[model samples]
Target: MLFKLLLLGLVIWGVYHFFIKQKPIEHKDKEADVMVECDKCGTYVSNKEAIIKDGKYYCSKKCAGVEQ
Candidate 1:
């Protein structure tokens, strides 16, 4: 018909702009991990999973006494 409905609306807008309107680019490979509080229970954690002792920063290793 009208050139097969303009080639089926340009193949449904090129399959909705190459597969359903594209929107998936979350690549964050490291840049939001520096929390670290827990000096024995103030408890914040995530300086790459806390626990460094003496200079403080524990979120476990049983609050950094380090028995396990």
Candidate 2:
């Protein structure tokens, strides 16, 4: 009876340890993106987030002297 109880307790402990533990997460590094800087504000931004005009980069229209 004690052996059976020990086996059941071990099964429950194994299930809890495997399912209720925090898992390790992994993410790929995005190195294909280019980094850019704002001319007026001196702020850094990704190329995808910056505005391009006349071969120059800017963070926003207001900083580029294009905003009303």
Candidate 3:
């Protein structure tokens, strides 16, 4: 009886370790595709999150100026 219980416990532990306790290793890049430049500050930023106004582009509102 004790031997059967020990075997069942070991099997359960092995299954749990294989399925639940292991994490999958996923490798991917989370970068933007297009690159843009700020008009005022002349800083570069990704197009995915850059701010745009009228016909010009800037990294932020503070960088947008009258010269640009």
Candidate 4:
């Protein structure tokens, strides 16, 4: 009776520790994305989303002087 109870408690503890009590994984070394400034409007934007033209960065196609 005591052995069964102990076994049940151990199983519960194991499940809680493995599934419920674990912390989510985080990337510590992941750096923030770089920001670029538009040459025409001086607006700041993420490098990944900014428009590039003639070796200069712009916030939009119109600012970059590209017709679209």
lDDT winner: 4
Question: Candidate 2, 54: how far from true, in Å?
Answer: 1.6
Clashes of each: 0, 0, 0, 0
In order, candidate lDDTs are 0.80, 0.78, 0.73, 0.84
> What is the lDDT for 35 in model 4?
89
Lowest lDDT sum, 10 consecutive residues, model 2, at 22-31
TM-score between model 1 and native: 0.27
Better candidate number, 1 or 2, judged by lDDT: 1
TM-score against native, each model: 0.27, 0.47, 0.44, 0.53
What tens-digit string does per-residue lDDT give for candidate 2 at 1-68?
99999999999999987765533321223444578899878888788988887888898888777866
Candidate 1: Cα lDDT at 35 = 91
**Model 3 per-residue lDDT at 51:** 80
Q: Write the per-residue lDDT of candidate 3 for residues 1-68, one digit (tens) a residue.
A: 99999999999999988765443421123343568888778788888767887878888867755363
Indicate the residue-level lDDT of 47 in model 1. 87
The true-versus-predicted C-alpha distance at residue 14 of model 4, in Å, is: 35
Sort the candidates on TM-score, descending order.
Answer: 4, 2, 3, 1
**Candidate 3 error regions (>4 Å):** 1-32, 65-68
The C-alpha stretches of model 1 lying farther than 4 A from their native spots are: 1-25, 29-31, 34-42, 52-62
